[model samples]
Target: MGEFDLIARYFTRPVRRAALGVGDDCALLSVTPGMQLAVSSDMLVEGRHFFADVDPAHLGHKALAVNLSDLAACGARPLAFTLALALPRVDAPWLQAFADGLLRLADAHQCELVGGDTTQGPLNLCVTVFGEVPTGQALLRSGARVGDDIYVSGTPGEARLALDALRGRLALPPAALQQLRPRLEQPTPRVALGLALRGVASSAIDVSDGLLGDLGHILKASGVGACVDATVATNLLAASAQQAVATADFGAQTLMQCALAGGDDYELVFTAPPAQQAAVQAAAQASGTRATRIGRVEPAPGLRVVDGQGQPVAQHFASFDHFA
Candidate 1:
C-alpha cells in the first residue's frame, strides 16, 4: 500500500479530543484556562528499543506509553499525541496490530491521535504526547526538599530482569521469562497516580532510566541528597520475579542492582515531605497504585544506599544514556 493509504488504513481515526486530527497540516489543541501544556517526545528504534521479533502490538503500546510516562511525571493529564512512524516496508498485519495497541492505550487515557508522518526507513516509532496541568501546579524535579520522603510507584526492575534474561546476561526459567516479558514490553504509564500527586508530591519523575538515575535528576535539581534503604528498594521487586531471581542463583546484590539501575521501568520515583506522607498514601490509594517509601531526602548532596542496619552498601549503578 502507498503512504497515505497505509496511514488511513491503520493510524487514522476520528479524534474526539483534538480540534483537528489526521488530514490536516497541523493539529490544534486548546488548553484549559489556567493550565499549561505539558509535552514530551520519545523515539523507539527497532533494534535499540525492541527485539526484531517483538510483537508489533506491544511496540505500539510502548511507543506512546513512554511519552505518557513523561506527562505522568509532570502531573499532567494526557490529551492527545502525534505519531511519526518509519517502516522498512508495509506489512499489513504488523501495522494493524500496532495500530490496535497504540489506539487502545490512547483510548484508555482519552488521549487522541491527532497528526503525524509516515516514511520509508528502518522501523522506528516516535510519539509526541501532549498533556495539560494547572498553571504552577505541574510537578517538577526541582521541587524536592530536605526531609522529603522518597517514594516509588509500582514495581521496578522487572523490565531490566526481563532484558537481562533475554540478552543471556542472566538465566531464568522459561516461565519466569514469560511472566516478566510484559513488564519490559508493555509498561503502564502512571497517569492517574500523577494526577493524584498534583499538590501532594514535592518533586516527581518517571523511572525510565533506572530508579537511581532518574531520582538523581530530582536530587540535582532540588539540590539535595538521599539515603535509600537498600533492603526496602531491593524488596520492591515483585514477589514472583524475586523468587525467580533467587532460583536462578542471583543474590541480593544482583537484585539490588537490577532494582536500582534497571531502566525501562516507566514507573514513578517521586518525593514528598514528611507532613504529606498521609496525603501521598491517599493519592496512591485514590489511583489504586502501590506507592512505597524507600528513602528520604537529606541536606547533603548525593545518593546513598544503605542496608536495613543503616550500613552503607558499596556499589555503583549507571542509568541509560544514549551518548555516554
Candidate 2:
C-alpha cells in the first residue's frame, strides 16, 4: 500500500501517555512533576544489526528494546517512543508482525508509540524513547566511587555466543544453538531492576557492548578503576553457554571470552558502596532478576582483571564499534 496507508494499517494507535500522538506532525510529551526526562535513540540496519532472515516480530521488539535499554541504564521509567522505519518494499505480513512485537513490548512497559515517519528505503528501524526519573535520583555513570561493589543483573554474553555459532565461526550442537538464539534475537530490557536501583546504585549502565567495554564507560565517567574477579565470569555465562562448554577443553578461557567481549546482552551493570550491598540484593529480589557482585570500584584510573587465585590477568578485549 502507500505510505499513509502503511502507517495507519500497522502503526497508528491511541496515545495513553503522550499529550499528542501519531497523527500530528510532532507528538508532545509531559514528564511527571518533580522528575526529569531521559531520552535515547538507536538505529538498526539490516545485515549490520540483524540478518535479513530474522523473524520480523522479534526485529520489531529489538528495534524498540535497544532504545528502552538506554532508559533502563538511566533508571528511568519508559513513557513513550517514536518509530521511524525504512522499508525496501511494502509487505503487509512483515509490517503486521513487526507492529505486533513492538506494540506488545510498549504495552508491557506502558510506553506509548507517539509519532514517526515511514519511507521506502533499505530496511532500517530507528526509535527514540522517552523516560523520566525523579530529580537528583537518576543513576549516572559518574557516581561510582572507590570501594563500591560492581554488579550485573541477569546474565551477559549469550548473545555473542549465539551470533558466533550462527556465523559459522563456532560449531555448537543444534540444541545449544536453539537455546542461545533467543538471547541473540530477543533481549530483555531490565526496567524493574533499574527503577529499583534508583537511589541505591551509585553508578549504572546497561551492558550493550561487551562487559568490559560498557563497564569502562562508568569507570571513565567516575574517574575510577575496577578490579574484576575473573571467577565471576563463570557465573555470567548463560545456561546455553555453560552447556556448550561442559565437555569442551579450554572451557574456562572460552567462557571468559564470551563474558568479557560478547556484546548484545542487555543486562545492567551497576555499582554501589559496600553499605548498599544488602539494598542492591533487595532490589534484585524485588525485581525478580538475578544480580551478581563481580568486582569493586578502585581509586586507580584503569581496569584490571584478576583470577580467583588473586593473580592478575591481562585483558585486551574491545567492545563492538560499528565504524571501527
Candidate 3:
C-alpha cells in the first residue's frame, strides 16, 4: 500500500471531538472556553525506544501512551492526538495490529486521532497529544512546596526489570517474565489518576526516565528539596523485581536501584501537602490505582535519600539520557 492509502486504511477515522480530523490540511480543535490546552510530543525510534523485533501493536500503543503520560503529569484530560509515522514498508497485518493497539487506548481515553503524515523512511513514530485542563488548575512541577508528601502511582521498577532480563543483565523466572513482558512492551498511562489529582496533588510528574530523575525536575522547578525514604523503595518494586531478588538471588540493593533509577514505568510521581494526604489517597482509590507514599518535600535545597535510620545515604545514579 502507499502513504495515503496506508493512512486512510489504518489511521483515518470520522471526526468525533476535533472540528476536522484526518484528510484535512490541519486538525482544528475547539478548546473549552475555560480550559487551557496542554500539549506534548514524544518520538519513539526503533532502537532507542524499543527493539527492532518488538511487536508493532505494542509499539503503536507506546508511541501514543508516552505522549499521554505527559498530559497526565499536567493533570489534563486527553482530547486528541496526531501521529507522524515513518515506515520502511507497508505491511497490512502489521498496520492492522498497530492501529488496533493505538486506537484501543485512544478509545479508552476518548482521545481522537486527528491528523498526521506518513512517509517512507526509517521506522520512527511520533505522536503529539493535546489535552485540556481547567484554567489556572493544571498541575505544574513548580507547584511543589516544603512539607508536601511525595507519592507515586503503581509500581515503577517492573518495566526496568523486564528490560534487564531481556538484556541478560538479570534473570527472571518464567512466571515473572510472563507478568513483566507487558509492562515493558505496553505501559498503561495513568490518565484517570492524573485527572483525579487535579487539586489534590501540589506538583506532579510522570515517571518516564527514573523516579529520582523525574522527581528532580519537580524539585528543581519548585526550588525545594526532597527526602526520599530509602526504605520505601523496596516496597515499591513490582513482583517481577521482587522475584528477581527472590528466586534469582539478586541483592535487595539491586532491586532498589531498579525501582529508583531505572525508567519506563510510566507511572505518576506527585506531591501534595501533608494536609492533602487523605485526598491523595482518595484520588488513588477513585482511579483504581495504588499510590504509595515514598517521601516528603523538605526545606533544604537538594535531593537526598534517607535510610531507615534517618541518615543520608551517599550514592549516585543517572537516569536515561538520549545522548548519554
Candidate 4:
C-alpha cells in the first residue's frame, strides 16, 4: 500500500479537533486562546532502545511515553502527537498490539494521535508531542535559582533492573519479574502530576537518563550547581542492602550504583524555590505522586554529591548515551 494509504488505514482514526488532518503536508491544530504550545520529540531504535525480541506493543507504548514525559517535565497538558514509524515488515498482529498499547496511554492522557507516516526501513519509531501551557508560565530548565529545592518523582532504577532481568543477570520471582517487566515496556509518564506542578516548579526535566546525569542538565541549563545528600539519594540502595543481606545477590553498593547511574525512569526531576516548597508538596500529594527532595541548587556552577557530614562523595557518571 502507498504511504498515505497506510496512514489512513492504520494510523488515522477519529481523534479530537483538527483543522487540517492527515493527507496534507502539515496538520493544523487550534490551541487554547491563552496557551502556548509546548513541543517535544523522542526517537527509539530497536537495538538501542529495546531488544529485537522485545514485544512490539511495549515498544510502541514507550515510543510515545518518552515524548509525553517531556511534556510532563514542562508541566504541559498534552494535546496531540505526530508519529514517524519505520519497520522492516508489516506484521498484522504486531501492529495491532502496538497500536493498542499506544492508544491506551493516549486515551488515558487525553492526548490525540493527530497524524503520522509509516515507511519501510530499519526498525525505528519517532514521536513528537504537542502540549499547552499558559503563556510565559511553562516550567523551564533555566528557571532554577540558587537555593531551590531539587525534587524527583516516583522511584528510579526499575527500568534498569528490568533490563538486568532481561539479560539474565538478575534472578527474580515470577511475580517480581512480571512487575519489573512493565518498567521496561510500559513506563508511566508523569502527565497529571506535571500539569499540577505548573505554578510550583521553577525548573524541570524528565529523568530519561540517571538521576545524576539528568540533574546535571538542570544544573547546566540554569547556570547553577547542586549538592545531593548521599544518604537520602541512596535510600533505595539502603533498603535493597537490607534485603540483599539475607539473599546475597544484590548488594548495597551495586544498588546504589544502579540508582545513581541507571536511566529510563521517565520520572520528573524538578527544582522549586523555597517559597513554593509547600505548594509543590501539596500539588504532588494531590496528584498521588511521591516527590522527593533529593538535593538543593547552589549558586556555584559545579554539581557535587555529599554525605550527611558534607564531605564530597565520588560518583561515576554513567547513564544512557545514544551515541555511546
Per-candidate TM vs. native? 0.97, 0.96, 0.97, 0.93
Question: Model 4: clashing residue pairs?
Answer: none
Give the better candidate number (1 or 3) by lDDT. 1
Q: Where in model 1 is the C-alpha error above 4 Å?
A: 243-246
Q: For residue 265, what is the lDDT in candidate 4?
A: 87
Model 4, CA-based lDDT: 0.82
Mind giving the per-residue lDDT tens digits that candidate 4 earns over 1-324? Answer: 666656766677774666766667888899999999999988888888888987877887899999999999998998899998998988778887888888888888888888777889999999999999999988888888999999888767777777776788876655565766787688999888899998889999998888888888888988999988766646854464334344436655556666777788888889998898889889899988888888899988878877778888775657667778
Minimum summed lDDT over a 10-residue window in model 1 is located at: 238-247
Find the number of clashing residue pairs for candidate 1: 0
* Cα lDDT computed for each candidate against the true fold: 0.91, 0.88, 0.89, 0.82
lDDT score for residue 241 of model 4: 37
Q: After the best TM-score superposition of candidate 3, give how far the Cα of residue 119 lies from its true spot, in angstroms.
A: 0.7
lDDT tens digits, residues 88-110, model 2? 99999999999999999999999
- Per residue, candidate 1 scores C-alpha lDDT tens digits across 139-184 of 9999999989999998788899899999999899887898899999
Query: What is the full ranking by lDDT, best candidate first?
Result: 1, 3, 2, 4
Q: Candidate 2: give the clashing pairs.
A: none
